[model samples]
Target: MALPSFFVTAGRRWLKLALALGGAAIAQTIPAHAAQPAAPATIRLDYLHTGNATVEQYAVERVVIEPLPWPGNMARTVDDTDRGVNLVEVVDKASGKLLYSRGFSTVFNEWRTTPEAEKTNRGFEESVRFPKPEHAVTVRILKRDENNAFTLAWSTELDPDAPDVLRKQEPSALRPIPIRVSGPSPDKVDLLILGDGYTAGEMKKFEATARRMADQLFAVSPFRERAKDFNVWALAAPTPASGVSRPSTGVHHASRLGTRYDIFGSERYVLATDNRALRELAQNAPYEFIEILVNNDTYGGGGIFGQFSTAAANSDWAKYLFIHEFGHHFAGLADEYYTSPAVYQPSGTRIEPWEPNATALRDPANLKWKKFVAPGTALPTAWPKAEFEAYSRDIQQQRVALRKQQRPESEMSALFKRELAHEEELFSRAPERRTVGAFEGANYEAKGYYRPQMQCLMFDRSEQFCTVCQDAISTIIDLYSRPAQR
Candidate 1:
């Protein structure tokens, strides 16, 4: 009636592997006298999101069983936050019972807004991951319509135990290094910080940079207050070169992740077009969220909700870039600043965005974050808009001239510091600068859109998020991990 010696050894090996995934803190949490919940295999559905401005389509490419077990909290399988432009739902195919769901945004959604998408079709490789199911299920991809209603965009039947499913993969030497271990992954928010453009010799440097940023991230509100509810991991496969490509500056490198600047014709935008490469290296880590750090010194980064975010690790504003982009990726918060350059062509109509922060303000009486707004504050809150616009216009001109003349990155950094200082001084004098009043000139528009606060980390190069943003972020934290005791 006793287990065989070989079987006992194999069970011990699996225990070690699971412990390694969580590091010392997690391993210690497993009591010697208690039973542990069985971890399920991670299931990933890879597909293509192809479309233009007017239409979109999805097609399944493959199904994969990742090497690591599911790290998400099985207790919180349903997402009720109601964020993101798209949602994925897994349901029992036989009984029509919802099994799991999560809201997410895709690169295809961002590209559809670009001018190039108006004239040509583009495709982005995308993937949706979830805990493997017990039986055959129907996977549904839902998209929001103009009125903010979700409709079934695509659906397919899937069998987790299918013979053709990709269950085996060649082992890679890469393993995630524990940057900060707080608890077991299922009970904590597991964040993976990936490094691109880092050489094998710079491995230590990557760890240092990732650790520094992770510390900084926890220093901010919401994250700061709930730091113990999260764990941080760092991973990178050495690249042949030391920096990612900056095509706008005519400097190109063979970065392993295909991350580069000049995305969508925006000089400062950075993104990784190679989703497969990004996901492959990422699966080696136990993570529910990812923030990639590029070793380049350029002022560029990008984030897509449910996909990932990238940040320039060596920029003067690297810390700010790390959190701001992560805001987009983590909470689906929208940018509030209107003066920055962008690649998307304006649609000129203000429709309510699904993002929690920005608003169309068509119904001012029912502002999305009205609960935070003080009574009697103007709906289209008045501020020194004219002066701010004038200053921003001048800064934009100087910014263009600097890039055109090939000015040093230091010069640009200094320019940004000066600009932020000017705005801080200007807004500091306002009586309601910190109040949660709807402010015009958000969503990259000079009009028709509003923001919950006059300035925020999403609005400017500020250090902390506004009260409304903080609340929004806190909501997501509650969804991922248990609420911090008051």
Candidate 2:
């Protein structure tokens, strides 16, 4: 995650400019709008030293910039090619001249807007290192159009020598600690989970939910038996209110359910949503193996490996979303169906997947889980197709009825809650709680889209991942243990 050497040189030039500008005039010219009372922008900078130096003593050698959500209600679209024009400039606090200037583009994937989507949504982080005496730095951003006309969007100052205020303020109970075990330290895999909304108090309420989700994740294949090898850091912070929801006409149409919307665009972040921002955050947590966003609601979540994973914060089914998505985030598991938003364009006609479970062909020779297939077992397990269809229809009808209710105390809540509770109780009675089966209601398809278990936490509102998922989680932990000594 180190910034390239060329970027370090650019930062130096920006600093030189800032030194030449001097501080007095620039300080006085603070925008009148900025002077007026408004919500104080909460900008946090965490300097991480990939080498032996401590973050405080570490001299920033380069600055990687990540822009954050803008402050307004506006529909703006920047393609990856068009985004490269945005520039970040670092200035010497005393001089106001630029110390470094670098340009980066927005993400290539198009993100549609909904009125409920977070407004002025920009999320990026920057890493800059300084030699000589570490000094205070002011960071400014200039976003330009095709004509090169620039508009100032953000400015902030930080002392590289100082410790991170937020880290220190984090409650000890909420901080991540190494998971200990007998023998050598299990390969450590850190999960740094970001938050959208869910204020500190709300986070506390949802902490148990988060921990339970993590526990369920580790309980699945790959992870369950190796619980001591991982660390989880929940970076819970409230997002701007404007970021809660937006109008959308695309895949985000799922947001209409209120139970499926993620105001912060969690999936976008994982898919290298914005290179500049992702790089910055990665630099901050260079050792992180996965980054999940815990949004504050009963909404659905998404995941992608080497990218990001997300889940609802306080939903009754939060545990299910967390571990199910982790299957995608950690093991590169594919959606067991052909539906949902076409976020990933299928290329070529190949069917076998690198994932451990999903398969496109009935032929054992082509499936990834051939080793696990039983002898003489049918290609597709016999399932109660008709019964499942009837059950699904019933559930949908109940969901529609519940959605129409206006109050939390409505009869609809009682009915939905009762059915959900009954399902949970039934799932709990299984002898091999971790075993996988043909679980209904998963991915986006109702037919071939089956999960590994008849009633796993991944496929329903249960509380534990199936054995296969546990194995996958464990495998990921093992993969991260050994260093690639290339």
Top-scoring candidate (lDDT): 1
lDDT of each: 0.86, 0.41
Using Cα atoms with residue i matched to residue i, what is each candidate's TM-score against the true structure?
A: 0.95, 0.50
The 10-residue segment of model 2 with minimum total lDDT is 69-78
Model 2: residues with Cα > 4 Å off, grouped in runs = 1-186, 200-216, 219-222, 237-243, 246-283, 291-295, 335-350, 404-443, 446-455, 483-486
Cα-based lDDT at residue 198, candidate 2: 48
lDDT (Cα, tens digit) per residue for candidate 1, span 237-296: 999989999887889999888899999888888888898898899999888899999998
Residue pair clashes in candidate 1:
none
For candidate 1, the clash count comes to: 0
lDDT of 2 by residue, 1-486 (tens): 233221222222322221223233323423334321111111234332122111112222333222221111011111111112245566778866454443332221123122222233322323322221135777655555334455664555666445542212212232322222111111245565554434545555445555566666666555655555554544443333312332221323211112224233432122223333443333232123444444444345666543466665555555666776766666555455322233433333443333444444435443444455455544445444455455556765665554445324245435656666755655466443333344333444454434555554445545555555556555555454423211
Off by over 4 Å in 1: 1-18, 29-34, 483-486
- Residue 145 C-alpha lDDT in model 1: 89
